[model samples]
Target: APDSPRALNGISLTIPDGQFLGIIGPNGSGKSTFGLCLSCLLRPSRGKIEVDGLDTSTPEKYWQIHKNVGMIFQNPDNQLVSTTVERELAFGLENLGFPSSEIQDRVDKALVQFDLTKYRKHAPHRLSGGQKQRLAIASVITMQPGLLICDEPTALLDPRSRAETLDLLYELHRGHNITVVYITQFPSEVLHMDRVIIMHRGAIVEDSNPRGVLSDIDLLERFNLDLPPTVKLADALRRRDVPLPAGIVEQEDLIQEMRDIPRGAPPGDHPESESARPDPTETVMELVDVDYTYSKDLPVSTPALHDVSMQITPGSFVGLVGSNGSGKSTLMQHLNGLLTPDSGRVLIEGEDLASKETDLTSIRQRVGLIFQFPEAQLFEETVFDDVAFGPRNLGMEGDELTDRVHDALQQVRLDPEYFSHRIPFNLSGGEKRRVAFAGILAMKPRYLVLDEPTAGLDAEGTHQIEDILTRFRDSGGTVLLVSHDMDLVATLADKVLVLD
Candidate 1:
């Protein structure tokens, strides 16, 4: 019998001291469930998990296992509970019955180590996404767990922030000799791991070194994951009969291959040297002299955007890239009048976006804004209820509502027959994301705006989402995406909009 459905199935693995392991899989492959079981966050129905020889089935042993294991969830907001950075760093110690003196000492040490001393007094919530993620790690580090498990900790962070968080984790692995178990879908991040394990349908499919695993292009495609850039480049070159290393997985390797190419060969003869083909008249989004600021009758409020002129157009996918606190979210909030500009104007169709009487609701209906972690917006009990909420809110009813809900479920790829009655909370992280997306799709919006929609998804989930968005565009729905995925932006966006 399968252990509890949320528990491991034929899953057996061990981490010797000082190992870095990266796990990859499609959504619902039980990667996170396995991690949770190991972390003692969830109990297995039949299988036993042991930490340093302590069986996890016993309450005392479970507690003991937790004392040595620390988990950082995908969302920093879910893990951070302290009002200030200093307190957040100290939270773990305080919970474990550490004395006040020791707790203070750990807090200071963690703050210094994480380079958060300057913001020790600042509220954690006010910190950038990356900063908040660092604080979450700092809080866990204060506990000094022997094994660290991070579940997609950088899923929704900006580029700089993501790099910083990865750097911090790598530092912890090298400096502290902490055994690291990381779950992620970002090929960029995975390439840096010492080892990678690929999971599919609740089982491990491939376990090898990072470079070796990613080089298996066939295996990656089988699991719905993309080859890393280096591997992809190598494969592309190979197809064109260019000489290159078989498992290239980084820029250095690609550069090495290129440098070794025949010195006198024409640039056009080498496929690797070929420039991107130019296309004529690609429509780009344009924003002209737009200014926006928040106000509430008080005089001290700060303006979020000022004279920000930009453009994004048809067949042109663009990224609104920025660090947290750099006004990325606020700017998107203005696209459909969720927040109106006080000065200047925004135009999508060369029409003003500031009129109070314009069918703003209809405008919202056109532009789908999936809030950051759309699960925050899910309120219904059953999957059906949750997905049906949006269309119903739009005044959809009777057979129309039913038909719309069914189509929406299909859009997110959730089987309405199996998932309709399941409680929203019972679904896995990937399932929850789909449910949330289904709610938005039920609205039948013309322009779609998403915020970190794939934060907790695995490689398969991410690919599915990208495909869905592509299809939506193909079906004539305009997309304005907000993501922490630079790779996705590079792969999908026709243009780039660096917000800060």
Candidate 2:
């Protein structure tokens, strides 16, 4: 244990009161570790962290530090403990010993502010991914700490929800003067921060204002970080003699610059569309008038899917998109018989799922489904065991099993030598997702059903997922991807499916 690698090495930084800071980095770069140490959740190995003139390493100061600092974890499931959404918001307030009436008032305000009033009485676990994220933030904000540290809080949200969350954080920073430390993979999200810090290999690589750091395309590329689309477009244009000014990171700025340039005549002809491909004669998976309702016989039953029907042909990539709690996840679960339809039928390769002759084990082996949260599926002691679980269960062993795990980890861009022996729980959010993906990839499934596979991944990690999906499709495997990222879906999917 003494020889183990340090998550944060000789890190020294200071944050003045009411200053909003942003931190970005690639997967496993110790951003989350730094946040834990700052919040006193994790003690530093060799250095000291002080907040409000109080040392974090001092046990007597921990309570005061916790009282003034609140953290929203990357995984909402880890922070959520109450049975209901309303109770979750009040749990912290009650712990801090707020009066009964004041607790009720704060809970009501949080429920309304986060747009969770509709699901006030619903169980926290039963909420959708975005809903759970909102609950996590609400629970933390209800306590109203002076320093708020958010770790990729918007990774699971849809576009609208993402914008709303950013706006909310900005408002809190500007209005309440809360010292905010926001950690995210999206460079675009940090455009408004007072300062930005880039971390890699457990060290701060760059520290400067957002514009100064983000405008450096070469610097971001060196770290395997993603440049905003507008910034990339501007850089490409400038390279081709477009003469665009520097520091163009926002969409509006780019648009204004383009408007100032002289416009040429409209193009004479639009680009021709690609030729339409013929439909497949056989459907690999199909849902026929399927319907499902959770807690069907209970008084508080909730309907999920209604008369859903679709077909997935062999070797085709299909994109599924919808708002949170719009049955996207519920629909994905039906593909592999994880949840049977309350009415109608699910057919896998022409075999009815409800039929006694149909084997669910075979269906699962052919179709590998990755849940939205990687934490739900990862439980092994080490990364090697987790990735090897699927293959070993199918009778693989010895050198063959070892090779399968190694190859799978390599495919996800994680070095087998470095990650094999590490605990899966200790990895960053993006790393955990990749490990779960490696587990599914090791199974060699014919069909890959992924729900938000790239949710918490960085730019390089996302590109790797795109490459993997493309390779899978080219190799005669079918894919049904569920994601809120429209650009990704457009680039990878052959066809798109919308769920309302």
Candidate 3:
């Protein structure tokens, strides 16, 4: 165990009471490790952590520490233990021996606060990605812990849900004076934090106020951290001799600053040119009048897709966007026959997926699906085994299999030598996501169906994914990307589809 890598190396820091702290870093950079240690979920190998004068190293203080600290993991599925949404919120309170009346009150308020009142009886696992993220936040805040540690909590959420979750956390911090340790890959989210710390290779590289840290674009780029779009634009403008004011992190600030700047004459309008469209007859994948429903014959039956029809041409990159529970994920499941439409046809390369003779396994091999939660797709003991599973099943063996695994890991920016034998279950959230992606990449599918592939990934990780997708597309691979980030979609998608 001593030979294993140290997630945190001689980290020494102290937090004041009722402070809102933000942590940012590249993938596998120990942000999650630091949060785990602070919450007492993980014990430091050598250094001691004290919470409210109580030593976390002391066995007797573990209960007190746990009672005072609540953590929302990067993956919501990991923490959800109850069958129903309401029960999930009450599970922690019930464990703490709260009264039934108070638990009910807290659960009711949390459901309403998270906009999950109508789905209180629904299973947590059945909720949409954004809904599940909301439930995870609600479950923790319901317990009303003195300290809260959130590790990439907004990664799975839609834009509106992200805004709501951040507002709720801010309210909890300002109104209740709850100490919040927020770890995220999004640089803009740290704008309002009292302090921000940048981590790299298990060490704190930068610790300062939000503006001080964010304004250092070179430092952030060096750490593979993403800059806010507004900040990047402002930096570019400043470099071009524009007198943009400092601290332009938010869109509003940039807009206000631009309003004060002198404007040149408006450019003459030109007619927009339409690009040549692909032939509908030549398609890689297509859905015809598709309809799907959950619990079709049961009392709680809910329709997911209705008359949905779309054609994805070969080597095309299509972006799917919608609100929470808007059937984006359900539609994706139909692509590889994971979920067959009740009354429609799914065709892959002119072959109907519903045909009895069509080989589903072969289709799946050609169309790799990356789940929203990376953990769901990872089951093997080690990263090497998981990534190799796909290629190995395709009859690859020996050096060929090893080469595929190593190349896939490298494609995702993971060092195969360092991570190959490492257990995936023990890796950081971002690392797990990358491993899952590498697994899909090793499969070398002709069509890649990704559901929020960039979710929970750092800036460098995101760019790596973008590069992989571009290369894949250029090599004649089709990509069906489901995402909530408009900028990502706009930058990568050849066409965009909106689902209701």
Could you tally the backbone clashes for each prediction? 10, 0, 0
User: lDDT per residue, candidate 1, 357-452, as tens digits?
Assistant: 567777777778887778777778899888888778878889888888889999878888898989998787667888888888888887787776
Best prediction by lDDT: 2
Task: Report the Cα lDDT for residue 458, model 3.
Answer: 82
Q: Weakest 10 consecutive residues, lDDT, candidate 3?
A: 266-275
Question: Mind giving the per-residue lDDT tens digits that candidate 2 earns over 118-232?
Answer: 8888889888888899999999999989999999999988888999999999999999999999999898889889999999989999999998888899999999999988899
Best by TM-score: 2
Please provide the root mean square deviation of candidate 3 (C-alpha atoms, Å): 3.1
- Per-model TM-score, in order, reads 0.84, 0.92, 0.91
Question: What is candidate 2's local distance difference test score?
Answer: 0.90
lDDT of 3: 0.89
Question: After best superposition, candidate 3 residue 305: deviation in angstroms?
Answer: 2.0
Q: What is the C-alpha lDDT of each candidate?
A: 0.77, 0.90, 0.89
For model 1, the stretches where C-alpha displacement exceeds 4 angstroms are: 1-7, 99-102, 108-119, 192-194, 264-307, 311-316, 340-359, 381-383, 410-431
